[model samples]
Target: MFQELKPIQVETLLETNKNETPINYYQCDSYVLRRDTTNSCYAIYVVKALIEILYQLRNVLFHGELVPNKGAQNVYKEAYLILKMILDKIR
Candidate 1:
């Protein structure tokens, strides 16, 4: 479902995650997420990245590789917001 977000919406999420530090990793440079010359492919790359990260997180949790902690508060909060945004868009 998340993979289906509009290009603009995906860009919005990518920007939010990058600037807001919700993911606790280095900010993803715009070029890394998309071609600098065009906006056509960024959304697809961003959605793919998001899904991959989520899948990695799921695996870590499923395998008990990393225990949940209070520090992940922002992750939960941001995830809900992103999901809500997608739901609202689809509806």
Candidate 2:
């Protein structure tokens, strides 16, 4: 899980989280990455997917596009990726 985060992957997650870039260059594909990385990958989705989802979330939140519900876990999941990134950096 946490073991699956490469330095670049961590950085990419944080960058996407901070900058709200609805894209990720680090991950090839979520479905494939879910298999390529590890079965219990660090994020609920691949780091790439989390980044894109978080960026979209920030956009929706910033623009008042819709009331927050349903996918709130996605943001929390992104936060988890951040924490994992920090922890991995520490290690």
| Candidate number with greatest TM-score | 1
What's the CA error at residue 67 for candidate 1, in Å?
1.3
The deviation in Å at residue 28 for candidate 2 is: 19
Give every collision pair in model 1: none
Residue pairs clashing, model 2: none
- Write down the worst ten-residue block by lDDT for model 1: 16-25
Which ranges in model 2 have alpha carbons more than 4 Å from their true place?
A: 1-34, 37-45, 68-91
Give the clash total for candidate 2: 0
Q: TM-score for every candidate vs. truth?
A: 0.44, 0.31
Model 1's number of clashes is 0
lDDT of each: 0.56, 0.54
Question: What tens digits encode model 2's per-residue C-alpha lDDT throughout 1-91?
Answer: 6667654443223223222243322444453122223344445455467567667766877798867776876765676688679579979
